[model samples]
Target: MALTLYQEASCGLIAGAAEAYFSFPFVSACLPRVDPTTLSVVLRAKYRNIFDALYSMSANKKISALWTNAGPYVKTRMGTNVGMLTSYNPSLCYLRDSCGLSETRAQLGASAVSAFFGAACSVPVKNVLAQGKSGSSLDCALKILKSRGPLAFFSGFSRQFALVGPPIMILWFAYENVRKL
Candidate 1:
């Protein structure tokens, strides 16, 4: 019952779309807290917590404001999921069979590979979101290109890779082992 790469990508696309749509509001609310520079741009007022932030955003700008960057977020999620899901199993099999790694080591290697690839694919869109710049994804991308150059799209890439890799490794390690039961 193994999935083809296309099937994996399809699954990833649907899952990522749903995840981005459902989570965008909460993510939008929390972003200003983690990246305070966004406060003046996004909220203009500091709230005590996420719920309060959501409430104020909805009140001040309408509920739709919470999804301001939905398209870009969805693109980021889809890229990450497609990159990870498409690569993970083959990477695992290669490490396990060709590299002759132990189960734990194979899972770890595969997850790290998947995470790095996914982060690389998604980080450009993520940078756009993090910047909280107005306009469509294309417009924002163009602005960044004109102002900061292509590398600006990957400004925090190493930090993002570090943040993404370990969680994915832990997840794959745990999930693969448990699924064997």
Candidate 2:
């Protein structure tokens, strides 16, 4: 539930978890495993449905006004502050023990995986709410909300720039400043 693109990018991608699970002695010794673009169509279809459904709910009227400033849907979830340090423990542990992927690669892989997961999980919802829109994308998410104002938050679009952008940018910029310090 707690995967951050920033943290992943800041570190790296590691496949230790998959490796550990995949490396069961019986399977390792039993047969050969080959990587394939083999996700089930049924699974993929479910994700598409979920995306469309959840995306809309983010904009639903009941979202806590407290989160009215939770940032964009993606931002609110992955925004740097929301992630904090605590959430990285599992991944860090996984990286250290289960997977040997470099911190940077592990993070990057995590981000990529998250994106894929998002596509899979939310695709269904997206299709339902925003399907048929020409090339639905992050930009489209913003565009739709730009004209929407307050209600936009419910759409889970929060336009998040206000709540999340400044703090995140500040941290990134601070890191840059620290390099000189």
- Alpha-carbon RMSD to native, per candidate: 4.2, 19.6
Query: lDDT: which candidate is best?
Result: 1
Q: TM-scores for all candidates? A: 0.73, 0.25
Q: Model 2, range 5-26, lDDT digits (tens) per residue?
A: 6555333212322323333332
lDDT of 1 by residue, 37-104 (tens): 65454434667887887888788576788887578778888877777778899899999999999988
Off by more than 4 A, model 2: 1-93, 130-181
Clashes of each: 0, 34
Question: Model 1, residue 98: what's the lDDT?
Answer: 100
Best by TM-score: 1
Clashing pairs in 1: none
> How does each model score on lDDT?
0.81, 0.38
